[model samples]
Target: MLQHLIDQDEGLRMVPTDRNELTTAVGQLNEELRGLPEEADPARTRVLTRWIGIGQMCLGNHDEARTVLRQSLDLAAALGNTRAVVATGLNLGDAHRYAGDVQGADALYRSALNTARSHHPELVDFALQHTGKNLMERGDLASAKAHLQEALRLRITKGDAGLVESTQAALARVELLIGRADASAADGAVPRQWSGEWTSWLQSRTTAQTPARWAEDFPALRDAVRGLNAHQRVYPRHLRDQPFPAELIAAMAAEAEKAVAADGYLHNGKWNAPVGDAASRFAGQVDLAAVVARSTGLEVEQPHTAVYIAYLEEGQFLDFHVDEFGFGEANLILCLQHERPTAAPSVSTTVFITADGCLECDLAAGDCVVFDGALTPHGRTPLTAGESITLISLGFRARDQASRTVTNLPPVPR
Candidate 1:
């Protein structure tokens, strides 16, 4: 009778829509276990306890779930049941995560992953997925991406469409958090060939009194000196408009808000912001590269560079710099939210350096700008005090050069 109840509970867990039924079933199972003999099968007892904990978690009883899961884990370990141990450990980790104990959750996940890797290879993907999620919540996006990528490979080989989709969704979230894995070269370092030239230009600009003086002295460094009025040539076309659907814009805004509320931003010295989760998922649903191609008249390849949303706060400023060769050939920026003190006189602007002079673009919510970020130098002016802005940045490679490796080329300054 106990074994029959255990089997029924397991089947109920597989169909989560019957939550009330499952909860009632778990209660009956617990009552049956209490009436069982002390000499009941230890393995069955371990599985029963783990399932009950999982049911508790489903009902949002994290504290109760953790306590029961620990008991099940101890029993599994004592019985030398590796599979049960791993499964129970993962559930315990989820309980910790649900209770906001990220550190505790990560420790349990790592233990489960290590044990699965050593004993139960077939179950490794499950451990990997949980560990990846725990790391993502801790803001270790690169590490999270690595784990999810491995889990994805394993899931694909297992040929489970549902499992594959779950891992893919987790990976997409990580990608949104930390742009593309290859968006920039390793460590954002400048290439050897351009380092000396970049250093020289920096020194000259530092000492030069005015833009004209720098332009006159370094005529050979025309490409390096930004915002210099040295030429009267026409620059590349830069279009600004509202092109995204209203619903999509609203979804992206909601994602940004949720990310901020959850403290999901990665605090690198460059910028601390959470890229929009909806934006990444939307990319999968739509052919964004083709949209870029139609708008810019450039043949764009699929799988464009990372799609990310950047949140800029007061006193934050982006220095003028050209993008890397392929990834930034065509760049898109969409303004999601912008707020400033009404009394403040200065307006923050996205500035592009062109042959004519500085072209300043003031964007509001729903506004977007498309430009050649790879060849042109661009940046944002410092936000005035009490000001903030949220912008989603998308990158694409021109079809002609999409196949080229980014490492082989020089790095673009940030």
Candidate 2:
């Protein structure tokens, strides 16, 4: 409940901004804590403690949060509790991160990850996801990739939807930085000729929606899409591997290469523009419909929402984490891969939005992919060498999410 309150008010808009209000809120939680059964449930107590910590943290009571989180972890240890350990670690690590103690935060997270391996692997996945995020911020690319990759693997294996979306977000950033297609959109409308029917017709023949043989009629697109599916296939460890159709893989690789080679795609540097890119379709009008439809495959059920974009470059990557609580209804990322040579990798990942497909398909020379921003926990993977135009758009799904999220914005706008 306190976390929900925090989600609703980062600036303490709901709670009085005075120290008195902070004191009262903590005091109320304390009263409940004193009554919490000593042996009834250490796990529950730990959970409650984490919440108390969060309420304190956002209310600018960092010291209080640390104390609460520490107590929470200690109680869990007494109960031989792994969940409490993970929860308390996360809470403490978050406090450390917020307090500018990155190293300390990282240590706590690493410890949590170790504990997770034995006691709570699921929680470990989350720990790695968070640690991966911290590494990204520290510019520790290789470690970031490993941690994020592990998190992605664990999330997918367990079908943990929340972490999956978050992992996808992180992977996209990694691709933008290293495997960037680096394609700059030609100064033209999203190609008046493109349509989802064309894409669907093309995509259906390749994945679960359709079969690969449909291309017998249009061999070029057929070959391209077919080849794409094959090339990107993660060959199974067992024998009789599903031969990632060589042609299919090559075709997508060619497309990724072409996309990256396009001008306007950054080659190997940084560029800055106004954080607000005028909506090409409507002035003072945000087409969140387009974003939602494209990213999530879900139609907008409401009106009166706005959308906007934020761009990043080679050295740019966001922390691995959930989108801020109440920033927008959903977040959409349209990546313009920086144009590059033919042998490079194009970035993509599976997503976890209950709305649409579970993955962000590989973007081609000119593909605009979207995913549920707020519902999906996401971040970026560090890049080795490349640039990208990541079009980040947000629409308000619920007023509270929009308001609660966005404590930190990508550096470009600031």
Where model 2 places Cα greater than 4 Å from the true spot, the runs are 1-28, 34-44, 173-414
- Cα lDDT tens digits for candidate 2, 1-414: 553344323211224245566567767877888898767666677777877887777675656777888888888878877787787887788776655455568789889888888888668778887787677655576788888898898889988786688788886676565443224223112321222223334333333212223234234343333332232112111112222233433343333333334422432132222121122222123354544544444455332333322223343433212333233444443332333334546332212212122232443322444443433323333332443433323343533222221223211110
**In terms of TM-score, which candidate is strongest?**
1
Give lDDT per model, in order: 0.66, 0.48
Error of 1 at 78 (Å): 22
Considering only N, C-alpha and C atoms within 3 Å, which residue pairs clash in candidate 1?
Answer: none
Give the per-residue lDDT of model 1 (tens digit) for 1-414.
222222212211223346677678779869876877999998878877888887777666766788889999999999988898898899899878766555568789989999999999999999999888888877688898899999999999999998898888888778876764345445344442353444344443432213334335444344444432221112344455646676777787777666556655543212434443366555655676766676777776654444334545666666555555444567877777778789998767777655554567888877767777654556677787888777777776666654333354334333
- Residue 29 shift from truth in candidate 1, angstroms: 26
